[model samples]
Target: MELRSSLGSVATLALVAVIVAMLVGQQLGQPILLGFVVTGSMSPTLEPGDGFVAVPPVLADDIEEGDVVTFDARELQGGGLTTHRVVGETDEGYVTRGDANPFTDQDGDEPPVQESQIVSVALQFDGELVVIPSIGTVALALQGAFGAVIGVLSGLPGGDAVADGNVETLMVGGGVLLLLYSFAADLLGSDRGGRDRSRSRKGATRAGLVLAVILLLILVPATASMVIPSGVNEITVVSSESPSSNPTTIERGGSQTVTYNISNSGVFPQVAIIEPASTGVEVAETTHWIWRGQSAGTTATIHAPDETGVYYRSISERQYLGLLPLSVIVALHAVHPVVAIAAIDLVIAVVVTVVFALAVGFQPLRFRDTGRDTSVVDTVRRTVRKWL
Candidate 1:
């Protein structure tokens, strides 16, 4: 009898909470987005599974330090939101850190989280997150599942690692259903003769508008290559179209300085990889070589020694993203001195990858590592900037 009463009380509390949540969600409308505490952002202060009643600042004045919060993370992109503790604040924005995180965040000045970008904060804390530490992994797997399904449904076939036609159909069908529901809700009203005609017209307009939006989403990514000017390689890598003259004297053995006029033939940034023609020509120990942006370059060292009987710099394959082989991998040639052509391609890939890493949550080298890793089975980076 006591246990039954306890269960009844719990049920009543849950019902009240649900009613309150619905009221809050309806009143706040867009700013108050719902989320659950998956991990310990507040740590001892807050635990897992504690569902948060997140609300964007009613005004910027509402923001204060120590309030567990959620905001947009730009580099994370794609509707990504991070909920963390506001350790400090600047005139520009709030300084946030997760309880689990030792470092505050990557940038000295955290990205000024605009009010428009904020999702709601948790006001309602029940217990903790659903899955715990293992939850993030599950979320990631779900994303991969959605991404893979989306990839296949769009008619562009993706990797065999995740090829399920049913999954693809489900994702697309679900999206269509959601859009139709939204459109119908917008057109809901009385329908009688003239009123029915008006409703039909409104419904047509809403459906057309929704379909147009869906098309825009699909076409924007699909036709992005056309408008965004993809594969428009701005960087010119000079592969020795003309073979070099063979010289076998010590006049060139010592540290010899030569000027390489690297001109940016394309509209994009260019990169060059210079190395010895083969294992035969040694780039004398402590031999210095480097190139800057324009005609006059800087100081640097060559990556690979003389091998493959060729020395040339080509735009990183990564620059040519549209081209399958050339964009990611130049060529797979197993030659002596381990001068693999694909390895040379990596030097270009790495340089471009290192530029804007700090802005994003991930370090640049780490990201370049993905493409570099894929090629690792067959190659390595042969470059002037060895690890950059």
Candidate 2:
């Protein structure tokens, strides 16, 4: 029961923190998203009942044709909001059209969308739009409930007393209270003879020193590599076709040659390797070396495996210090990019968690041998002070 309570408390605390941060950022006029889809104008791209996670728009010059954008359409027909892809750009603004629509918005009597009307760009992950389906339904339900309550309050004689919008403040306060409650609970557990009583001061000091050394060893080289300047390596695929000049299509048990143009723009010469590995599928492997401030052209023969599926061509630049190689892998499947990055992230998280647990575990125990009163309030205060 105690373990369950502790886990529940951690989850609740994390949820409250996230909510509070979102609300605070929204109130501060950040480009934080608080929108839900109600229309299907962008069907096949964004469906009805989808949730939007709005990101700050790129510079107007950076907004290229075919980019999906969300904007205010209050003055347009149907009068609410709209998100569409940019079809063409004009001197006036952007010519927007929905992916599933038969014609452009201009064809429907709406003028070209001005840059001033643009709100934000819908965020994309792994080259695909980020969307959470069915979440909009929950948002709509909450909006309806709030509207009904506000309507009732407005109908009352002393409406001003209840109609004030303090929801953000209330949420922030609730989050703070939740944090305090969690801290108090931890203190209470510690006071109830939950601490180990056999550890010595010398042992604790030695354990702490070892933990610090381990952390420094892991962090120092990583930090130094970032600060140090390494040669810049650039790679561009010149062609992926064999002698026939036709597009290279890898069928079952086939081979193809891909030519690449590699360049080095820094003081030192760089080596780039094209290694084939199974990141969901098998890819062809090759390598090349380029001189400083010069370019090199090389070809690699890629062999397709017997089983047919998607594949990847991983281009990696080898660094001098022998750290992890910087890689740019072209994949046949888009989700493979997200999966590749997420796998690396998961490994780092696991490593950090294990190291942290070991470091904390090795710390000497607090025996609670003193005769000083271990009352709930006193324990809570001590815990708060220690954390602070």
Candidate 3:
């Protein structure tokens, strides 16, 4: 019975962790481990409220035709992330189409989907999608509840200050509170009448589960902070003989410097690197260290073509938490931004795991047997009343 109960607890915790990941992924607009469709574009295969396991591009094998991928769509649904099946390969990119659609995306305004734009691939087994029915519906309902709570909190006295903070920050705070409440409820409801119960109750598994939850609470927000704000910044420039005061207007055959503000609104200090993404743009300073809730600026020089014309240029920024040395992060980022993120996450997980293991070795946390007769529900009610 004890072994079965322990297994049950572990399974419950795992389910909760997956649900939390899905919720965070939705809020971050990235498929952390799962992705879902809001429309019936993939109906019959994956219904509108269904979700599927998403393997990040970094971890997944090479993309191939017939694979369902989630990519940054250039035209479909007004240019956002879209999930569709790869139908054909071209020199330019891959042709994609919704499973239920009669025509490929290229038949419309959307161009071929590039490999770089693909974020995740839906996991499949035996050529069938691993679907989680109605998970998206549950996630959407929870998100709506979060928004409602934020609205209510914003209306309270001095609550606007709290409500105005980053949504991810609020989410982390709420998650912590929820965890604490769950622990409290579990503690209050546990039966403590029999001495045999105390002898049989082994808490090593529970302790490990708690530690896992704590680690996730740390990792999810840290990853989001680095990812949510980092992306390409596109700037338009008009090169002409008569240059205006606008920094974007450059004299033909000359150069203009524009300032790009880098801000860290998260709770942790961050190190950011900005690099030129186009030929005409060059960053004056590629790296910056920013304290939490602070901002910094970097300059990018844009050279106008000899022939007067309007042009577009871009710069990309990648950031990581200031947990590791600047030089190490820079070296890892040189390989790929995702590499740096993965390394940082790995380090954090290792350090936290070691600390937890040292602090709470595998042992049963036995409670004293009090000779009082009380129903579990009554005990919980009494505990709640005392807190109130």
In candidate 3, residue 30 scores what lDDT?
73
Candidate 3 residue-wise lDDT, 151-203, digit = tens: 77778897677566566445654665456546654664365325444765532
Better of 1 and 3 by TM-score: 3
Worst 10 residues of 1 by lDDT: 230-239
Model 1 misplacement above 4 A: 1-33, 36-61, 74-80, 106-117, 125-141, 156-173, 176-388
Off by over 4 Å in 2: 1-31, 58-61, 145-388
Worst 10 residues of 3 by lDDT: 365-374
TM-score for all models, in order of appearance: 0.27, 0.39, 0.63
Clashing pairs in 3: none
Winner by lDDT between candidate 3 and candidate 1: 3
For each candidate, what is the lDDT? 0.39, 0.52, 0.78
RMSD vs true structure, all candidates = 24.0, 16.3, 6.4
Give the C-alpha miss distance for residue 219 in model 1, angstroms.
Answer: 26
Residue 173 displacement in candidate 2 (angstroms): 10
Error of 2 at 381 (Å): 16
